[model samples]
Target: MPQMMPINWIFSLFMFIMIFIMFNMLNYYISIIKMNNKMNNNNFLLKKNNWKW
Candidate 1:
């Protein structure tokens, strides 16, 4: 007898996983961007106030 796994099932699972990974990557990038913006703003403010590292 042929194995019972359906082709559509496997394809759907792969698609779901790919979408999930993409979402996670997008979320990670957004967080990084937010942090970078915050850091840049702080640096700018500090420079305006004559602060140094």
Candidate 2:
């Protein structure tokens, strides 16, 4: 039973690290998508204003 303890600890640590990395990647992509949307909206507004003139 004692020999199995270290293995469990290592596995738990690995799982935690993997989860953290996945969360960070998701956040990064979300921010990038938000920036892209903002850029697209700005371009759309600019085109609309030009047409009004």
Candidate 3:
């Protein structure tokens, strides 16, 4: 039981770190997608304005 306790603790700590990194990566991708959409929208609007001229 004593040896098992250390193993379980280590496993839990590893899982926690993995989840933290996953969440950070997810957030980073989401921000990047949002930025891309903003850029596309701006470009579209600019193109439309130029066509009118």
Candidate 4:
């Protein structure tokens, strides 16, 4: 029998890649949420300043 540990290698590499993908996705959503909050604040500020117009 020949041994190169192919099964474990594939499983571990796939797991490593998936964890990386998940971390990137989490970072993207956090940025999006922060941007959305800023936009909302700006809108409120505009309305507060332009109440006569």
Candidate 5:
């Protein structure tokens, strides 16, 4: 039982770190997608205004 304790802790810690890293990667990708969408919307608006003029 004593020897198993350290192995269990190590396994849990490794899993926690992996989940944290994946969450950060997801957030980074979402932010990039949002920025690209904003840029496209602005470009569309500018083109519409030019067409009106």
Candidate 6:
């Protein structure tokens, strides 16, 4: 049991780091998607306004 302790610790640390990185990546992509959506919406609004003129 004592010998397995270090291995378990290393595995847990690795998993934690991986999860953290994945979480950051998800947030980064989500923000990028949101920005794209906002830009599309703005373009649509501008087109609509131009038609009015």
* Alpha carbon lDDT of each predicted model: 0.92, 0.97, 0.95, 0.93, 0.96, 0.96
Residue 13, candidate 6: Cα error in Å is 0.5
Indicate whether candidate 1 or candidate 5 has the larger TM-score: 5
lDDT (Cα, tens digit) per residue for candidate 1, span 1-53: 24656777899999999999999999999999999999999999988898467
Candidate 3 per-residue lDDT, tens place, 1-53, comes to 68799899999999999999999999999999999999999999998887543
- What's the best-to-worst order under lDDT? 2, 6, 5, 3, 4, 1
Q: Write one digit per residue (lDDT tens) for candidate 2, span 1-53.
A: 99999999999999999999999999999999999999999999998887543
lDDT winner between candidates 1 and 2: 2
**Preferred candidate (TM-score higher): 4 or 5:** 5
Looking at model 2, the pairs that clash are none
Q: Kindly give the number of clashing pairs for every candidate.
A: 0, 0, 0, 0, 0, 0
What TM-score would you give candidate 2 relative to the actual structure?
0.83
Model 3 CA deviation exceeding 4 Å by range = 50-53
RMSD of 3: 2.3
Model 2 whole-model lDDT (C-alpha atoms)? 0.97
The per-residue C-alpha lDDT of model 1 at residue 35 equals: 100
The order of the candidates by TM-score, greatest first, is 6, 5, 2, 3, 1, 4
Which pairs in model 5 have colliding backbones? none
For residue 34, what is the lDDT in candidate 3? 100
